[model samples]
Target chain A: MSAPAQERPHLLRIGDLARATGKSSRAIHLYEELGLLQPATRSSGGFRLYEPGAVERMRWIDLLHGLGFSLQEMRGVLENWWSSEQGPAAMEELRVLFQRKLEETRESIRRHRDLERELMEGLAYLETCRACATPAAPVKGCVHCTQDHGMKEEPALVAGIMTSPEPGHRSGRGSFVRVEDIG
Target chain B: MSAPAQERPHLLRIGDLARATGKSSRAIHLYEELGLLQPATRSSGGFRLYEPGAVERMRWIDLLHGLGFSLQEMRGVLENWWSSEQGPAAMEELRVLFQRKLEETRESIRRHRDLERELMEGLAYLETCRACATPAAPVKGCVHCTQDHGMKEEPALVAGIMTSPEPGHRSGRGSFVRVEDIG
Candidate 1:
């Protein structure tokens, strides 16, 4: 007597899977080798076939990968999903992990901001130096002055003074001149 | 007809500088070669001598190095300070540069946190799978059903189920099982 035939499970070819999961055929093959995924069956022509739920499984893997999980880590997670009897504990653990990661990210942001402040201050100094090279009389009664000397004077000390004039001035200078004061 | 005597600048020998700046004599020489610093003069015996302020400048360089600034960048900043007529402009440019570096560092930290989260989740799933390997009962309801019912049942259908029982199991033979009511 012939044995009764069983109903076949849902199956999809490699091309169909690639399109559905937005992954390349090569990547699918790689995942199978890593034991991260399994094909339901093979056709007479030796083409790989996936079951009905394979797409969902692939989606989960893709999401984890996007979140920076390694292929090995994803395999472990899938294994837990497949064999664990208590689902709540696993889900809880996952939530805790996410929270910890968020905290670390916030700390990193704080350190980066501190470094940013330091660099900004450095840049400000360069701008001030460039402005001083201009051939203008010192601002009289400016906030930088100790005394309120409002009267302007002629540029008599221009010869003795080591000046870093603006670009294209009479002195063909390559380097900036270190001057203690503009006046 | 002797020329008028020029005022001599204060100078420090290599060993004296090492003591003042807490740097090795070799390091001081390296700094001189890199142009990050300079000695005030050379002795008759070819020994190097530094000005009083040289130690202070070296200390500043050390500070910037600790903060992760490259020698080249430090040199550029120092050159600007030595040559620039305006201190404020140079400081401003430095501030902007620091801000850019801070942003890059923050991005790196964010990526690290994401990776950490993925790893933690993966580890949690592995733990649950290990717990569910031993079947508590002969045949429990489907794993998916248990997840929906809010019951803590052994994971039997999930992929990557642990083959060995967890530590401290009395019987240590059957699969870990926890059945939950689907309804």
Candidate 2:
């Protein structure tokens, strides 16, 4: 009785674990092969069996993966968990991972937003130009005039906002702008 | 004289143009192929000759490309400028493009910031855990408890982020803490 309890702590078949975790059986096998996860016991026919608690650990691994942690990183974290007595260090590591993921997500959202804005502006400009056949007269003495605007100084509001190139091309002299210099 | 001015525009050889733009000849040729730029004239021997103004246009193209506009997108913007007589429409399109680029830059910055945050958090968590050998008491409640306090509730975010599976496994069920009824 003692041997059976030790070998099989609520033994679970591979299929049962896969369904509970929403992972394919093939993936489960692969994880086992990788040594990331191990089964608690083997059946008479040589089927893998897991303890009920394995599901929780698997979920944690999945969450970390989703947050963009590499397998190596995950291993490092897991090793930390396994080797060290459970304490503040493990919790702290988990927190750090969370913070990194949050930052990445925010950045992605910001980039998409920028793209959307550019498309809108381009479309709007096209529509306006279509309506007006003539180039707007170069505004005289206007700080924003493309010709008068120098790279040295910019209005505070427009600083780091946008970059505009010189009005016309001059042969032999290439006029190029750096996108980063723009706002 | 007028015909010559229109025909050649004081053509500069490709080498000189490349020197002026601080770009490699290969890159210049690639740009030409992409239709982001062109030489104003061709030599009798089929050499490319750039007019004085070609350099500036190339510079602008380079800048826009760095700003994340694809070659095709740059071409569209340039076409509006070169072909359209209506200045207003062209200006409008430019405005739109600028707006879009700005947003994209912003987003990139944001993601980087988020990543930084997450990394720091992970590092801190690791440090704390390392320093303290005791495991923090497992929080009460269901599996979702940890997730509720941590991950964001955005499906779009979930879809966009790429994650690698656990190590040593081709596939494995990912563990996640479902904080709530996040669909």
Candidate 3:
């Protein structure tokens, strides 16, 4: 009974846009409220309709979010660029921001990589304990373990758990290696 | 004059413990409140004192925190292990927990690595745009760039920025490749 979509200017309803973009309606509304998104027009029934370009706009927002920009910060980025008179100057500011973010990302990766190595070493050590023969071994005995763990030193992760209270300086026995010492 | 540290049972005051552990006094208090930590005793003036082993315990807490356990969850882990009858069973639970965390850490590393690549590719593409000759060129013209950027295809990070609203299918010009399409 109505006109074809092609003849009527192909606009997407809000639900359709949300489905296509994999964003919740509430999230789309928040983006609209934050000035990150705009509707192309309102329908005869007062429903919001979006242009096809809005899908690409959503992708832009997501990319910025993944790069650790808050919505408020993203608005600031847009406002600063649009308000500036020179395009090259605005772009240079963006370049500096991107460079700083890149450094932060690299640092994060480095820290996580260290953590990954620690975890792998910890797992390898734990695998040896799976067939632990001494069920009757006192829990405290793990601190001074004599059974060869087949490694030069205990991993920091396991050492942290087995660290026992040190004896006084007068005592002759050697102290258990603390986690910090291993590091 | 106050007695020497060695003569006074060698306990650490809260301030000394915080300094040694690199945690705030408030964070230590929270750990104590959550049953994840405990003070060995109180001074005559009501100040908290900790045993030397607390330093190693703090390291354990940091290791678990780095592995993504919430303070409450850590409390649960301790309770479960301490309450169990068998040593091997408790160690087995810990082994499983460590294995799961290793997988999660690897996955996180993969995602961050991807982000790092995207950032590098984006920075590379933007380098080509830094020396644009057409300061007078319309801002929208970037979406359909005629300049040869030396890359076979645009990176998703840059493509997301340069995407423009499409003309009708009848207009016959080739469409800009979207970020998701490249992905």
On residues A15-43, what C-alpha lDDT tens digit does candidate 1 reach at each position?
77788878998998877766666655555
Largest TM-score belongs to which candidate? 3
Candidate 3: residue A54 Cα off by (Å): 2.6
When summed lDDT is taken over every stretch of 10 residues in candidate 3 chain B, the lowest stretch is B164-173
**Tens digits of per-residue lDDT for model 3 on B1-183?**
233133246777777778899999898887777766666655555566677777877887898888788988877776665555666666677789888998998887787788888788777777777786655555456656777777888776656444533221221123333222432
For each candidate, give the interface RMSD after superposing the true interface residues on Cα.
14.9, 11.8, 10.1
lDDT of 2 by residue, A1-183 (tens): 123222344667788788889999888776665556766556645566676656765665575675566656656665554444434544555555566666676665565565555445444433443344235643121224343232344322122112322223323423333222323
Candidate 1 per-residue lDDT over residues B55-164, each given as its tens digit:
55776666566456787776665565445544444434554655565566566656656555544544444344334533342212223333222224332222222221
* Steric overlap count per candidate: 49, 55, 0
Output the worst ten-in-a-row residue range by lDDT, candidate 1 chain A.
A154-163
Which regions of candidate 3 deviate over 4 angstroms?
A1-9, A136-146, A162-183, B1-9, B136-145, B151-154, B159-183
> Can you tell me the DockQ of model 3?
0.20
Each candidate structure's TM-score, on Cα atoms with residue i matched to residue i, is: 0.36, 0.43, 0.77
Q: Candidate 3 residues A23-92, lDDT tens each? A: 9988887876676666655554455667777787787778778778898786666556555555555556
- Arrange candidates, best TM-score first: 3, 2, 1
Candidate 1 docking category?
incorrect
lDDT of 3 at A46: 50
Evaluated on chain B only, what is the TM-score of candidate 3? 0.77
Report RMSD for candidate 3: 10.1
State the weakest 10-residue window (summed lDDT) of model 2 chain A. A156-165
